[model samples]
Target: MTSTAIPSAPRRSTFAQPIMAGLVTALVGYTSSFAVVLTGLRAVGATDAQAASGLFALTIALAICAVGLAWFTKRPITTAWSTPGAALLAGAAAVNFGWNEAVGAFIMTGVLIAATGAIPWLGRTLAAIPVPLAQAMLAGVLLKLCLAPFVALSTIPLHVAPVIVVWLLFLRFSPRWAVPAAMAAALGIAGFSMGRADAAGVMGQLLPSLEFTAPAFSLAAFTAITLPLFVVTMASQNVPGVAVLASFNYETPWRASMLATGLGSSAAAFLGGHAINLAAISAALAAGDEAGEDRSRRWIAAVSSGGFYILLGLASAAITALATASPEGLLEAAAGLALLATLGSSASSALSDPSSRMSSLVAFLIAGSGLSFAGIGGAFWALVAGLTLRLLIERKRH
Candidate 1:
């Protein structure tokens, strides 16, 4: 009998690649964290500073996952806190009770997530779901975000249209430079507009200051914040996160990753933060070619991301200075453009599968529609739809 040969895995080049990726991921958080923080803070009625603290806490927690795993495995494993957690809280805060109650929801949700990690069934169940379906759902979930730049133009046509045009042209021509180039162009234009127009509340150098609010527990906040958040996270973020890891052929223990994230967020919540989880989207940046040429050292990039994020979390004031340093308009445009690729990729991939494609398509629509029930997010709705279709279709075939 002829012996079959097993393929040898590639060797990693250096730790520098993962280190740089980690740092860049942290650097992105410096400015971007404000968006999530503001939304979550307002949801719970925390002071702006408290919201910043929440973001700071989230960042610190994420760093812990990246660093902890790297130290243990000696392979850089990257992780991040939830960006969508802030988004989830924003709506939950607005519709639900007070901020203290929202914090209670945060704590409740984190505990549930941690518990979910401890159970082997959770991993098996989530794993049974098709990677393609999950990926598609994620892309669909972000469809609107991809279209945001263009749609945003209608709201402020005069100021933003030029950059949109330039960005569109660049995207049409260069393809690769589309996202970053659009980013630079948009920020440049927003800055120019802000300088000329001088929008008062949103402009000028804003200083970071400290403030505190006591947290109170409430069932309403917990239902709105905790339940919906966990579902969205499990479906939208972690499902796709695992898919991305699969794409890269980097296999870290899923249960271990979840446990780490849960513990990290559990600690972060006491200080004031929403949730922490593996880095799904940002991990792609470093784990992909953007981090470096050496493939095996991808974990190193994740480790780097964690360390730098911790530094940012520690120097909360410094993070604020740089973000508020730019014109708010610039921040908005820069953010929109910078995030476009992630949005587009998610939307595109969600539709990639042909079999049960409609099921996933329905999932995408439900999830991306931003419709909520019981304070749960669109991600849950999409998964529900996808699963429903999967079950019905399978049953009919039998």
Candidate 2:
């Protein structure tokens, strides 16, 4: 009898490289977007405690979804609270609804998102949004945040310059680490500038706590906030997120992913979070070769990122405190640096198709205008204008 040697599985790197990749991915994602989340919460009348709880809830829910989905799908599917949705919430606050009503709106938005997965036509319609228009809307939504660094330089040059310098210098060698380095520098400068007593006060009570805001559904919320939030989350966040995965040739389980995001958002909304959806920029970090040389092992990067997210969620109080302790524009600067690549990519994608150029520009400009009408943000209107213009333009050609 001839003995045949069994094939061994590919050996994963025993070094901390994969873990580092995950850690960086998690840190970047959390730091880059957490500031916006906080601002949105505060805008919607959340007390500091409530805002902290929202961050904690969102992070934990997304962490669980990321870990579970990545493990099940064998793909790197990073989940996040919708950044644009948060921005919309911030703007929607102008309508002066109480936080409870906002939570109700969040619940409604999550239901709509979940319904898309359960309802075929709805999902197809959402999925069918023209890529250029969606990309344009996202670019518009990001423009404000991406301009933070410039704003910071103007407002707090002394603090921001060194951070920017560090980022630029590091970008030449370690592109991934540049943003994190800048963030660390910002935090360091902020801490020192704040004085020891203030810094200590900021670090007070480092524990995870849940704060529930009961839902108060209203027709106004449904039309003004919920619908727009759902649309932006779908078009600007989840759709682009899924596209990133597909671009890398990952056959994602779209239905399952959407269902998971909707459930996570619903659960987190009760605990003060707004929405949780697929991550676009950070997903690329975890799914690509940067995660690992071997595609099969990249899931570990996402799992590690999820674990770190949970830990960060547990320390939400400290995180919020630190963010609050920073100089007014410092967090924005750091976040802008983190989003620079994403904004550039989205802009390029939006204008790449010559046929969609005019319509895409219209969407981009409107969304970037930061206008709000009837509690709906520029993003929604931008989409509407873009679609209308595209229709009119294309009809003439035909």
Candidate achieving the largest lDDT: 2
lDDT of 1 by residue, 221-324 (tens): 66556765666577666766777877877776666777887777767776677787766766676667766777766667777777777666665644343334
lDDT of 2: 0.82
- Which stretches of candidate 1 lie above 4 Å from their native place? 1-21, 28-47, 84-94, 128-145, 162-228, 235-250, 284-301, 314-339, 353-355, 370-386
* Each prediction's TM-score versus the true structure: 0.71, 0.86
lDDT for 264 in candidate 2 is 88
TM-score: which candidate is best?
Answer: 2
Q: Can you write out model 2's per-residue Cα lDDT over 61-167, one digit (the tens) per residue?
A: 99999999988888888888888777666555556468888889888888888888889999888767787787787788778877888988888999889999999
TM-score of 1: 0.71
Scored by Cα lDDT, where does model 1 land?
0.63
